[model samples]
Target: MSRTTPATLALDRAGVAYELATYDYDPKAERVGLQAADALGAPPGEVLKTLMVKVDGRPACVVLASDREVSMKKLAAALGGKSAEMMKPADAERLTGYRVGGVSPFGQKRAVPTIVDAPAAALPQAYVNGGQRGLQVRLAPADLVRLAGAQVAPVT
Candidate 1:
């Protein structure tokens, strides 16, 4: 096993149960969620991706299913913001200390408001990036909420 990443470190410190899954990563892949699902033999819906956006000039982390898109209007309404836009890849990397495909809700370089799709709360477990590409962490949704200080909302 390699050294724990920021995401895994947060999970460990929170006493959250999780399984680490690592695989060969292809940088050219277009859809990272689909690739991870295929590699892990899991359903696409069970694998969620973390997206960073600027909500009312502040950073907010949005976690949604790999198969779905974040509803910007709905997210704005839920966040009490007039609008939300996806952060630039460079800004996201700078803010989270993780690259585009490897953004995780926990252990970001800075604490940001986080919102998770309601469906994630219904799942027994979910696989999210482990703070780096080619690695993922399988953990309980409740633990994710607690660790990220995320509110459950309908993000898609």
Candidate 2:
């Protein structure tokens, strides 16, 4: 599989340090992020799943550990919005310029507000999608927060 992607390019442009990892993506897996963590043999907490959401009807991005689930109520509160919900799969793909399972917070088609779960943000290293299926980038959570301009919150 190709190692270069818009996600990597964005990181490069920002001078963010990260390592690329590739694995066999399982389309049949019920949870993409869990499958990715298993494929990487890493802790579930260190594998972040990028989710596209609409907070108060506005597009937003959320990054949280693969093992956790987002609390929509908490998410809304964090964003100072009234409500939050997952974006439609197709809508998410369209908005982020990536397929459902390959969406990454970086290099999105449009810049949107981003929230990183407090737990994930505390990790010294985390793995996230690399703008494509079967690819992930390992980097410090600090770098991810800084690069994505993500707000850290307990939304999960």
Candidate 3:
């Protein structure tokens, strides 16, 4: 088998069954979710993206549907932090060792606190970035949470 990325490797090591999908990447694209959905034939809502944010001066990860936006106030309150703000793309890449379009909850350089939108847990499976811009991993919601050591909350 070919060597997988850190994110996919972590999922495999954790015994999480996932399907890897690769697509042609377009850097100028605005809606990554729509692009992925169109390319992979998955629903926009079922494909998730990992976002990096700062909560009370600490870096954290928020997983939400690609079509939705993260409510900073709700996220901060859920995390018991005073405020939350989106991390800069460069900062996110530097911290996670993955580029902006390829951030994944698993296999980050640093183990940051992670919160997944409650609705994501209800999905049968979700497609998330596979630690690389051109790749994605589809896995069960339970497995994703287990692999990422994420907390379930209302992140959307």
Candidate 4:
């Protein structure tokens, strides 16, 4: 467990409680979220990945299950945009203040609109990147929603 990261601090400011989980990180892993789920010994569906996307050229955050893919059409519609695409890794990092493999929905450099796929709320608790690679935070779905100021939609 490490000290407070911006993500954790955001949770603190929101009066949200969470537990931290850390594991050995392998840069070679193709899917960061899958790797984290495996390390945390949780089902892939219980772990969410924070994705940076451009909806009509505006940056936004989308979170979904580790095992699922975000549907661009659905995400765009959710954001009232015509189209959406994944953000470039460099741009995503710069905008979110986190590395490619460790983007979190909270504590961003700027307040970006966030959408959390509805499926994530099905789980009792969810694991998400803790603003750093190899670190994760577990919290109730309601807390996550509140902390991220996220809208829930069927975007996965």
Candidate 5:
């Protein structure tokens, strides 16, 4: 399958090293990240999930391990905000210019503050959405942090 998405293009432009892979996307799965981890033969910790959230009513991007859950309290503290919550699917799609399951932190429509969980940062490599359903981009965690200007924090 062609992997030339906005996310890929952004990586290309940045000259960052990355790889792409695809899997059978299960829309019916309870958690898309878990399904992706299982399908990719990767540990859940190596598969990162990109979540669109609002911190004090403003949008932000959060990257963390699929096996972990973001603590809203920690998220707020990390971003220096008073409160945080998941953005509505439609709002997230609109803000990021990607469908819910396909949202990638690499090439959002508008750049927002980003945070990479400490767990993901500790990984040598990690996988995140490739701006499309069933597609994943694998790269060094350091590259992700650099490319996204993401603050590393213990949000999970």
Candidate 6:
């Protein structure tokens, strides 16, 4: 078994029950989330891709379905910012303390504002990166809200 990442540790500290899943990772895969969904045999909608964005130059995370695209305008509006842009990969890695393909919403190096798209919250459970590639954590949507202190909004 792989070592628990800060994300899993945070869940533990919060007393949240979660399931850890690991699979063979193809580093060359184009879309990280789709690869994980295929490897885990889970529906794309059940797996969310955590994206880091800069809203008004402040770093924040947006969690949306693996197959969906985040609307920058909607995101900016939801966060009450004037503009939204995807964070540079290098900046994202540096800020989150995780690689580009494995940035999870939990246990970031610093706690940045996070917005969970409404569609994701509608699901009973969702899979998110567990702070490393090929690792995923499945937990109730409510747990994500409580653990990450994420704002539930329609940012997708």
Question: Against the hidden reference, what TM-scores do the models get?
Answer: 0.96, 0.98, 0.95, 0.96, 0.98, 0.97
lDDT of 3 by residue, 41-129 (tens): 88889999889999988999999888889999999998999899999999999999998888889899999999989998779999988
Question: In model 4, which regions exceed 4 Å deviation?
Answer: none
lDDT of each: 0.88, 0.95, 0.87, 0.90, 0.94, 0.90
Q: Mind giving the per-residue lDDT tens digits that candidate 4 earns over 34-98?
A: 98889888999999999999999999999999999999999999999999999999999999888
TM-score of model 5 vs. true structure: 0.98
lDDT string for model 2 (8-80, tens) is 9999999998999999999999999999999999988899999999999999999999999999999999999
Q: Write the per-residue lDDT of candidate 5 for residues 25-102, one digit (tens) a residue.
A: 999999999999999999999999999999999999999999999999899999999999999999999999999999
Alpha carbon RMSD to native, model 4:
1.0
lDDT of 1 at 11: 87
Candidate 3: count of backbone clashes, pairs at least 3 residues apart or interchain = 0
Question: Which candidate order results from sorting by TM-score in descending order?
Answer: 2, 5, 6, 4, 1, 3
Candidate 1 per-residue C-alpha lDDT over 36-114 given as tens digits, one digit per residue, 9 for 90 to 100: 8888898989998899999888889998788889999888877889999999999999999998888889889999889
Clashes of each: 0, 0, 0, 0, 0, 0
Best by lDDT: 2
Candidate 1 residue runs with Cα over 4 Å from true position? 1-3
TM-score for candidate 2, residues paired by index: 0.98
Better of 4 and 5 by TM-score: 5
